[model samples]
Target: MGIFIRILGAFVLLSATYNPTRWNFTRWAEANWGTQMPLTLLFGLLLGVGYLIYIGATLRSIGAFGIVLVAAIVGALVWVLIDYQILTLQNPSVNLWLGIIAL
Candidate 1:
């Protein structure tokens, strides 16, 4: 349960910050900057803090080498999925799938 929650949190944070859709924080901030500067800054800082916490925990748990290894594994998995016709690179949702796999 804890692991699932952590993954969910990371996914939410990542997608909320920047995604293919225009409903994310970056898009929101860009569209409302002039009228909502203060709120924008506040949310930006909050997001920054959330990133710091997650990044710190990830580094502390796995270190840089582990991160690289994990990335390599993920890359290989994606390749295998493509090779096996399980995942199609041309699909629009592949981006979202990749993002989810990152968690």
Candidate 2:
């Protein structure tokens, strides 16, 4: 449940900020700032920091490397299930690899 909350928080942050097909907080930032790069970097930093904090707080039992490994496994599994079964994407291998690395 803790891990799920962390992941869900990250996902909500991401979708709120920069979902490709959505009007989001990032768009508002870009519109006001007249630039996208700095906002992008800021949000990315926030996301990374938030994830680290969550992991440290809730995943200490697993340690750093174990947390990363578990995240990679979960990311890969989700990618496979969604891309293959739900989306039926034509080429999901790249997404699977990227998801593992990202998580």
Candidate 3:
């Protein structure tokens, strides 16, 4: 449950920032910039806080090297899938989602 919660949180943070669905903070802020600057800034700051907390804990837990190691492993697995024709980089949206999930 704990692990699941952490994963969920990371997903939320990433999704909130930018996702394949094309609805996220950047778009929201851009659309409302002229009319809702305050609200947009508020949400942007909140999202920044979320990123700080997540990134701080992540670095403290694993450090940069660990992060790279994990990424390399995942990249390798992704490469294998591509080799096996399970994943294709031809679709940019899929690649973007994979990159987001990988992060």
Compared with the true structure, the alpha-carbon lDDT of candidate 1 equals: 0.88
**Candidate 2 at residue 83, lDDT?**
71
Model 2 misses residue 24 by how many Å? 2.0
Better of 1 and 2 by lDDT: 1
> Cα deviation of 95 in candidate 3 (Å)?
2.5
For each candidate, what TM-score against the reference?
0.82, 0.43, 0.83
Stretches > 4 Å off in candidate 3:
none
Question: How many collisions per candidate?
Answer: 0, 0, 0
Best by TM-score: 3
Tell me the whole-model lDDT of each prediction, alpha carbons only: 0.88, 0.65, 0.89
Task: Arrange candidates, best TM-score first.
Answer: 3, 1, 2
Give the per-residue Cα lDDT of candidate 1 at 73: 91
Tens digit per residue, CA lDDT, model 1, 1-103:
9999998899999889987888899999999999999999999999999999999999999999999999899889878887898877677666675756576
On a 0 to 1 TM-score scale, where does candidate 3 land against the true structure? Answer: 0.83
Give the per-residue Cα lDDT of candidate 1 at 88: 74
